[model samples]
Every structure is written in structure tokens, then in C-alpha cells.
Target: MLDLARERQGGVSDYRIAQLLGLKPNQISMYRHTAVKPSNPVAIRLAELCDLDPATVVAWVNIERATTPEDRLAWEIILKRLAPQKRLKQAA
Candidate 1:
């Protein structure tokens, strides 16, 4: 999400992203560094900012945070279903 925002036209800083998300700059840094994951609402907001589907973003995050293999598999299936077929093939 941070990368997508930074790569946007004119770009956006971490501080600006934090403001946009109603979070602290350090919190944004934590997310950027993968030290923490954003909450569901925040994830949805990020998906909007990145012009991505909220379900796809949420499923991707759920996959990353899943503690059990079953949960991870479920999220993976959802993500695969949500993603384009061409991208799925390339991801393989």
C-alpha cells in the first residue's frame, strides 16, 4: 500500500499517508516495515487509496496473518479467486 501510494503521480510521503489513514506516522512506518499489519478498516481504506478491491486486499492480509494452515489455505483460495487469471498464472 505504501509502495503503491509512493509510486502514484506526484507521490505521497509516509506522513501524508498516515494523515490520510488517520494514523500516526510511526504506525505507517510499522506497516511499511511489516512490523505490524493494519486493522480491517484501515486495510479497506488502503485498498481504496490503491484503487484495489477491498475484498482482495483483505484476503491478502488475512492470508499473511493466518495462524493456522487451514485458515491460510482458505484465504489463499479467496485471493486466487479474486485475482485475475493471468496474474495468478504468473504468480505460480
Candidate 2:
């Protein structure tokens, strides 16, 4: 999700994205880097603003919350959701 955001960010500053999400500029880096999980509202806004698939964005947050690092199951689930999103972005 962070990768997706970065890819789409263009000339938009992290501060601008933070404003869009109603968060601190520093917090944007944390969320973008996945150092912390963003709240549900932020996640929803992120999907809406970036035209991401809601399920895929939420699934990223879910994967971030996994108790285990290197969780293959979580990776598979995320990959499954992302495939269509990737295709759609490419088509656009």
C-alpha cells in the first residue's frame, strides 16, 4: 500500500497527504513506511483519495497487524487482492 501511495504521490508532498488524512506530517512517514498501522478512518480516506481498492487497502492494514513476521498466508491474501488493483491501474 505504501508502495502504491508512493507511486501515485507524484509532486504531492507527504505533508499534503497528511493533510488529506488529517494526520501529522511525521505520521505520514510512519504510515507510508509501515512503521505504524494507520487507523480505519485514515485507511478508508487513503483508499478513496488514491482510488485504491478498499479491500486491498484494508487487507494491507490487516497484514501489518499480523502477529508473525514473514507470514506467508498474509502475503498470499494481500497478493490475491492486489492483482486486480494492479491490472486496473495499468489499464488506466
Task: Give the TM-score of each candidate.
Answer: 0.80, 0.60
CA shift of 60, model 1, Å: 0.4
Candidate lDDT values, in order:
0.82, 0.73
Per-residue CA lDDT of candidate 1, range 1-92, in tens?
77896566248788888888888999998887765788889999888888777888899888888989999999999888877854765689
Query: What TM-score does prediction 2 earn?
Result: 0.60
Which candidate wins on TM-score?
A: 1
**Model 1 regions lying over 4 Å from their true place:** 84-92
What root-mean-square deviation over C-alphas does model 1 reach? Answer: 4.4
Tens-digit per-residue lDDT, 1-92, candidate 2: 54455457765777777887788898887865656888767888888777787767777776766667667477667769688878998899
Give residue 27's lDDT in candidate 2 (0 to 100).
Answer: 88
- Model 1 pairs whose backbones collide: none
In candidate 1, how many Å is residue 62 off? 0.7
